[model samples]
Target: MSQHLPRWVLPGAVITVLLLSWSLAVHFGHAPLMPSPWQVVVALGQLAADGRLVRFTVASLFRVSWGLLMAVVIAIPFGLWLGWSHRAERALGPALQLLRPISSLAWTPLAILWFGVGDLSAVFIIFMACFGPLVVTALNGVRKVPSVHLQAGRNFGLSTAQLLRRVVVPSVVPQLLTGLRQTLGVAWMVVVMAEMMAVNSGLGFLILDARNAGNRYDLVVAGMVLIGLVGLGLDGLLRRVERLPGLSWGFPTARPSAAPAVARLRLLRNP
Candidate 1:
């Protein structure tokens, strides 16, 4: 039997084919609106040579980092408290539910009014985008912690503080990490949108600037590609951090080794 192709290989092939097709289309069309891949590369190089790319990128990175960090600091504590205490959850549930559905963009006007048009307003947008998702995912992760573990902690005469620190917190870490992954994406997205409106520097501002300066389509496309690539890299880094041996200890353990035939069968047809 032929071995199955690796999953990564398929995605790589698809991307290569799509980019080739796009480049050929642009070359044939010879339109400024649709610059060829080579043109985009050249544009990127020119921008980098002028130092504009690095400066804008640093500005965007700082906004995202600060906003995401603030979100985590607030969300994790609130989520854990709600998950641990019924009273807190009951009190906060209605307000959280109300605020969670509001789009991050909707907060832009108020954010501008409160923080003015600058880094503070941009960061506020990112914070709002990251906050709701982080809180919800954290609550889910913590609430889903196995009851048996808590029971065992109680059996050992552990106080509430000890039980939380020793058992509950560690058990819920994977879920928290997963939440962070999602929040990080939202934070990145919000940063770009916020910058387009509130800030005079960053990738979002650069994209708008390129558009206003007349058909700089290559720059707009390059900025979008940069955002997507950076987001993917950040999530991959988080996944690697979570897979560290000690970090995985509280995570579910896999069953011991099975026959190769059984493993293949299970993969093909769940039992």
Candidate 2:
């Protein structure tokens, strides 16, 4: 029997073909302003040699960590309450749903006003981007907790706090991690937008500055490549966490993720 080709093969071939085509097109089209893949690589080397690459990447990461941390501290508890109590959900659902439709970019103006033109403003923007998905993830996960597990805990004479610790938290961990993975990606993307106007040093600012200063498209492309690679690295790390023992037990019945609803919100905001 013949085996199928590996998943990486197709994608690698497509990328190789695209690069060849791009180089040919640029050479023929006489688009001197456009940077070929090799030119982009050279530009990336220049940035790395100057230490700008590490410095800018770290600055962006610092903002994302702070913002995501703030969101987790607040959203998880609120989401738990909303899931465990029908009344709480009914009460706060409308307000949160109203806010969910607003894109993080929409809040950039207010974020700048509230936090000023600094790292704090960028961090705040990332927080706004992360909060809603995490809440939804927690709420959905809590709702999916097996009633038998809850009953078994209660029958063992576990108190509310004990039951929450032993039962609810473990049950929710898998979904929460997945949500975090998605949220982290959103936070990374949001940081670029957050950096564009209110910050002097970040990959986003690097791209913008490159464009304005002598129209250095090579640097712009290099910055974009770095953003995508870093995002992929983050996702790979999260995937490792997902594969840890016991996390998969919760996936037999995964929660309906908030991503689709969030996509709809983006549509509404953009339209």
Candidate 3:
């Protein structure tokens, strides 16, 4: 007769409570900088009605997707080679390590000059963000494949190419997926930052534009919520893909139960 809520229920309830608190704060705090949740909702609806929101959202998504595609094409093969061969690793590792510490923001000025203040610049920044993480993840994943697995592949008469295809690739899949999730999230973030600096037609630009138009706090708040929602949606999609049967193994095991089952088992054994 007892009701046991699903695992997600408590988190959902917590979020609802937080939103309510935020709404109340805006109403009672009488702060102009902090608009009520209803105000944000109203602004969001207006943006949707006006159609600029869709255009900017799509533009941002487009920039990230293009950059991510480019990164995948270049990073995967280069990473695989570096991971599989010591010569390639020696040649590339120091350079990659050197660049890893330099953020996408640091490259923005050069990207702006090289590509100009346009979509290309924004996409280039996203590319830089995606490339390094993807390469590092891919290379680390591949390099970590167990030698015993490779030996088993040789035992099964796999040639070098076959071994790579059938063994190495499969073994690193979980890591690849993990890296991919991180890469895409970073790609999205870079897209927003790049748009703010270089381009005039994305969500980030919209936020800047709203801020410039003076006291369009509603619009600014709306834009912030939209970005959060879009990022959440993208991550949710990735998580769903990761839960597919082939991909499920990539995730770590659920936390272990701590009940005293062993004590009960011992009593049964004695009886």
Candidate 4:
């Protein structure tokens, strides 16, 4: 019998190969500005030694958390409303469409002007970055909910609010999770940019300060690496959430051909 490779093997191998190639290229090319992997590791150690690493990381995450919370509270319900009522969509859709096309970066100056150069400005920028994708995903997901599900919800005599709560929201959670995952990436990016100009602390500020203060490209690379690692962890968390029993409909597990077919479909929204 042949054995398949472990799930993590391929990805680990690819990353190992890339790191090795990067180290070799920097060694042979003698690139002065670019830091080798080991140099970046040392830079990370330096950051940790000074305690700036943890502080910066926490600051960035705090702003991102606030922004994500704000977007979810505001955008999800608005999207649901737009999806549920054609009249609401018609009235609000044009404005939403107009703003959705605007880049989050475009809001940076205005954010500073309105919120001032602080945490609020940074959070506002991240919120703007995350808002559009979340709204769009939620709207589309609600629209795609099976009509039968809605009809059954009504048959049970659930009130409009109850129907939306027990019916529509759960129905769209999978898509919303995907939106959230994507928005997490956007939030990280925007926060970093916002921090470079708006705030005095964070990984973004660390990177900018390192470069400006001493041309410490190693610290810059280290900051980038940290961002990538954190982003990957967050994405994986959302992926795991998608596979949770409550949202299994969003991410069904594959069954082996040798096993008997068994559908353990779970509908958490069922009345």
Candidate 5:
């Protein structure tokens, strides 16, 4: 199995070994608190059979989707504006910097007080978790756009809106996509915590409920595994989008037919 396989095979093999070791350890240790992998698998199957897993997963996904959409819509424009205007960045940068260091869990008390333990509270928490980094990323992306492109757009007698639409937005798309991917990852990470504290119907709540109802460690582990797998799937989907032809403008790809100028020069000299 180790001999002639591709590089990706090693990671899967490592994960399998780790899982087998974990299952063996739990089985032999007889630790009632930790459920074996097989127990978690059985519990997950039971959850699916009862449809609770699907319901809870969908609830969490809904919150994350809405939260990320809101973050992207608001953050990108504000960041673009901020990047364009030195005055605006100076005015808001300090405040944002102050707030960015605050952890999402730190807002749990205020989230509960303001929204009172519901979907809104959970969504709000997820939104805040994603917003700050996204803004910063977008601003950086806009700032990184080349001055030549801006000058070229202006030379065409473009209006401010036209310049943004034709020049800035297209140039920033790659960076924005990168930011979006990072923001969504953080959003997913925070949603579970937010749901646990602020909502009654998500994968996070399922884990908490499992513990409280009957100390069901198997169910808790099952919920954790589902969250991990779903997050991985979502990220994989986003990676595919990032590699799409139109969206992947700034990414490096092989140009099989083209040789480097230095290589061409050397070949001509030798020939």
Candidate 6:
């Protein structure tokens, strides 16, 4: 019965505890830097009343969506090709490895120089942040596809393209989904940073603007809360995708009977 409880219960409890602790700290410590959660909530309400919160959130979401779309389009095919051909992976993998370690924030100066402190600059930073992890994950998924599956496809007289489309792609979908979830988190973080420094309109800008305008720590905290909530919602949506029937092959499903059988087999082997 306990196991059947909603998955979110634990997380909700944790968040509640954290928020209570934050409120207490703000009240007791009288720290001007940290606003009580209620103050942030009120600030968010005021922003909503003025319509700035919606505008900033939408702007940030638009940049992230466009950047992620572009990264997915370019990375998938290139990763597949690299995984299929040893020569390509060998030739290109080193460069990717070297570049992957460089933080997306490091690209801000160059992005500003090239795109000139606007939506394009922020989008470019998000693209760079998402691209590397995506390519690496896609390549790994392709390379790890079972050779037996490929052989079976060949035995059925499928051409290389047919085998790839039918077998290789299906096998890679689960891992790709996992990679996308992770890459999206990185992209979200990058967009906020980019917006703070390179762009004039976004949640990040809201945080900075609030601070600079009147030292409104409450509004700054409000912006931070909004970013976290939005990121959580985006991740939750992707998690739902992973549970879809077609994508469930990538995730483990509960099987009580199979677990007992596995335990029995293990006991028999040990005996």
Model 3 TM-score on a 0 to 1 scale? 0.87
- Prediction-by-prediction clash tally: 0, 0, 0, 0, 0, 0
Candidate 6 lDDT over 127-172, as tens digits, reads 9998898898889888887665566566566688877777677778
**Per-residue alpha-carbon lDDT of candidate 3 for residues 1-271, written as tens digits (9 for 90 to 100):** 1158787888899989999999888878868687788888899999999997899899999998999999999998789888999898998799999998899888989998898899888888888888888888888878776665565556556688877876677667788777888898888888877888999988898888888998788898898888888998988898888788876552122342223223322333345
Which portions of model 6 show Cα errors greater than 4 Å? 4-9, 250-271
Candidate 1 overall lDDT versus native: 0.81
What tens digits encode model 4's per-residue C-alpha lDDT throughout 1-271?
1158788888999999999999999989967798999999999999999999899999999999999999999998889889999899999899999999898889989999999989999999889988888888888888877665666656556688977877677768888988888889899888898899999999999899989997999999999999998888888988899899878553222432211111211233341
**Colliding pairs, model 6:** none
Model 6 TM-score relative to the real fold: 0.89
Roughly what TM-score does model 5 have, to 2 decimal places? 0.88
- Residue-wise lDDT of candidate 2 within 42-109, one digit each (tens)? 99999999999999999999999999999999999889889988999999999999999999889888
RMSD of every candidate to native, in Å, equals 7.6, 9.4, 8.9, 4.9, 7.1, 7.5
Candidate 1 per-residue lDDT over residues 1-271, each given as its tens digit: 1258776887899899989999888767757588777777888897799987789888998999999999899988888888898899999899999999999989999999999999999988998898888888778777876665566556556688877776677778887887788788888888888888998999999888888988798898878877787788989998898898867555342442224323332332333
Candidate 2 lDDT: 0.86
Output the number of the lDDT-best candidate.
Answer: 2
Question: Each model's TM-score, in the order given?
Answer: 0.87, 0.87, 0.87, 0.89, 0.88, 0.89
Model 3 lDDT, residue 184, Cα: 89
What lDDT score belongs to each candidate, Candidate 1 first? 0.81, 0.86, 0.80, 0.84, 0.83, 0.86
Among residues 3 or more apart in sequence or in different chains, the pairs in candidate 2 whose N, CA or C atoms overlap within 3 Å are none
Better by lDDT, candidate 6 or 3: 6
Query: Whole-model lDDT for model 5 versus the true structure?
Result: 0.83
The predicted structure with the larger lDDT, 2 or 4, is 2
